[model samples]
Target: MSDTSPPKPVLFRSYYRDWIEVYKKNAVRNVTLRKYLLTLSWVERLAPDLRLSELTRLDYQKLLNDFASEHERQTTMDFHHNIKGAILDAVEEGLLEKDPTRKAIIKGREPKSRKTKYLNHFELHKLLESLELSSTPSWDWLILLIAKTGMRFSEAIALTPKDFDFSKQTLSINKTLDYKTRTGFLPTKNKASIRKIQLDWQVLMQFSELTKPIEEDELIFGSLGKIFNSTANHNLERRCKKAGISVISMHGLRHTHASILLFAGVSIASVARRLGHASMTTTQKTYLHVIQELESKDIDLVMRAMSSLN
Candidate 1:
């Protein structure tokens, strides 16, 4: 019998929804899934009726230009890549004659200049001294740990009493909290992020006393319950004000930790490992200014040593 059914028209939004359901949802983490959904929302807004066969390069460029108008260049790139992945998949499925996103120019406003998000050694010491850690677990404890360990907020929040090895003075980071999903014990950001951080004697003693009364499996900071990043930053800002130090976000403590270590002549590789960065490249890119400053000091030291030898 001859086929007589009409072919279903594939709208851009519909195909993207299907692609996300079948390929992206299970493959990505909840945080990543949320990002994909956000990008899909943009696609829906700009090209609701755009058919797969009718989507020209001009239409796709218009979408990118529209999104880039409000976002930073890096963000716009991420948005472009997300949509392009699905569009390429559609092409492979013979839904389109050619890719519409090819050679699309990225456009965006210039990023605003911002001050460094780390504290100096003296400022950090002042901030630490301000915290009252007398056998009680609070956000102060969390801040202290992050400042010393350079752990990500998610990794630090997910920690339990059992994660601390007092005898060995090591803290294991094998899991992360999914704040977006309000779930506990998700995998770390990357394989490299799963590491054991060595702890100072003082920190170990403080944590030992703090964790003594808590259950082995209970989170050190207890349940935060849907706390937003801005809220956390605001709290940290208050702490900084109380400490009489310049205000910095919670993540700034991580940066401060790494910066202090690098300034103290720690190897880039060791700093990268301690920070749980996926690669040295990531650490380098994040603290390029610090690295450049350190290079200048190294040049001066080399010249002094050479002159002294003569």
Candidate 2:
């Protein structure tokens, strides 16, 4: 037998980060990669100073036991499970001794459901206008792009000049950047996420202008050697505060765009294609409120016509 053992220091960083890298390398979308990294950051905060090998089931359980609400606890519990799941994968790959978080009981937590808060059309336009008035013009364009494209913030930030097809007016959103993996080659949350979007005229125009002085392999939104979204977001938040609007996430623009498209009589497939959704189901679920409104309006018109006929 060889005298060498596996690197004990390998598991020192967050296991969640390692899994994120795995996802990135697998070609995951940038947005999904970022969310996973945020989840990992939360885990790191709860177990600050603890190494990967230092994790215990009890320690993991302890992190979730202190939530004020069952809902909060459960939400955190799922996040806990994800981290533990990552560690388990490491163990399977001979990266660690065993799954230290496996036997840990998340007993105090209660089940809870979660949903994303999306923005409305008026709110979106207001924010877009406000962003334009800021010192950073890049954010104004970047925010509008996501709102129109329904790209996750990271996906938008990780976008490169090569990802755009100005001639076809199409965008290929395959690679993503994450805190764990700063590259575009990563696995997105779902199989369908690795899809393409045909850009609208406005998006194409903005992209063309942005890439005017840049190269194809270079990131379209590159800054001083990094993606520019975070700094843009910070500036955006400051601008929103000055405008007396709530500083919402960049992703909220995605919801606003979806709703507006549905209201404007765009087909679900068309919207899904632009948003790079894997299926119509995702597009429908996301815009269910707008769909219901359309249904209600249709019913009213139908009833009015029947009465007129009588």
Candidate 3:
């Protein structure tokens, strides 16, 4: 007589790998793909024996609690989002009875103190004055470009003489350098990132003279060789200390540019385009504090204008 036995249930980790291979592997950028792979590693580590068919809301909560114990709240939220996508698909495929992630509570460790993210007008002026921009391209030049144009480091480093239009005083942002992998050129961060940013006369003239000797297509800052974001941050930190301003990261230069524009009463839409943000929502969300402060000033102006009408 032949005996029949039940098939072993599929491991949740295995299902997640299949989900990533089918849904995420080729559908996202290499940097984004690596994030999914990282989520997979965490799944394997945290739920090694969890079966797809046995996933429950309780089980999912426990897994998140475990993850949260090691990370900050924002990081925990990102991790939850990454895994939730796969879990939802698994449910639709009839591999699970229901979504285990619904109503799941996200918790995490306390966030550490953050560094100052931007400089004010006077602080920025001092920082710029501290930079020593010489005839040759240097990190200081890169710092100044970001401070002026709000360009991402990758976008600024990928720039060449051909990207600049001196007559129009605009710079084309079409690609970004793959500084992390040393893989040459890559597409911009998003479709919106491919844009033309107008340059002020001073910056246009400075760059025109600077790029005169370099090849039209050669990387503006690539001569530095295998530059990392940290390299730029160190240079910026030195300048900040020398100028006696608050220390900020390389990314802070971006924040500084955006903040200055917003404070100067430039329209949010215009600043959003200059920053190459995918949406004005991103810009508004990132600078909500600045917006609120500006709104208060607007209210004061409104009151004064109304009183004058009497």
Q: Which one is best on lDDT?
A: 3
Candidate 3 lDDT trough over 10 residues, lowest sum: 1-10
Residue 137 Cα positional deviation in candidate 2, in Å, after optimal superposition: 7.7
Clashing pairs in 2: 23-187, 24-185, 24-186, 27-186, 27-187, 28-186, 28-187, 28-188, 29-188, 30-176
| Model 2, position 29: C-alpha lDDT score | 53
Report model 1's TM-score to 2 decimal places.
Answer: 0.91
As for lDDT, the candidate ahead, 1 or 3, is: 3
TM per candidate? 0.91, 0.61, 0.96
lDDT of 2: 0.67
Q: Which of the two, 2 or 3, has more lDDT?
A: 3
Residue 170 of model 1, lDDT score: 100
lDDT of every predicted structure (CA atoms): 0.89, 0.67, 0.93
lDDT of 2 at 115: 39
Span of ten consecutive residues with least summed lDDT in model 2: 65-74
lDDT of 1 by residue, 1-310 (tens): 9989998887989989989999998788888998999999988888788888888999899889889888988899999999899999888988888999889898887997765599999999998988876667776788899998999998998899999999999999999987766766799999999999999999998899989998999888875556566777887888899988889988899999999999999999999999888999999999998999999999999999999998
Task: Tell me, by TM-score, which candidate is best.
Answer: 3
Better of 1 and 2 by lDDT: 1
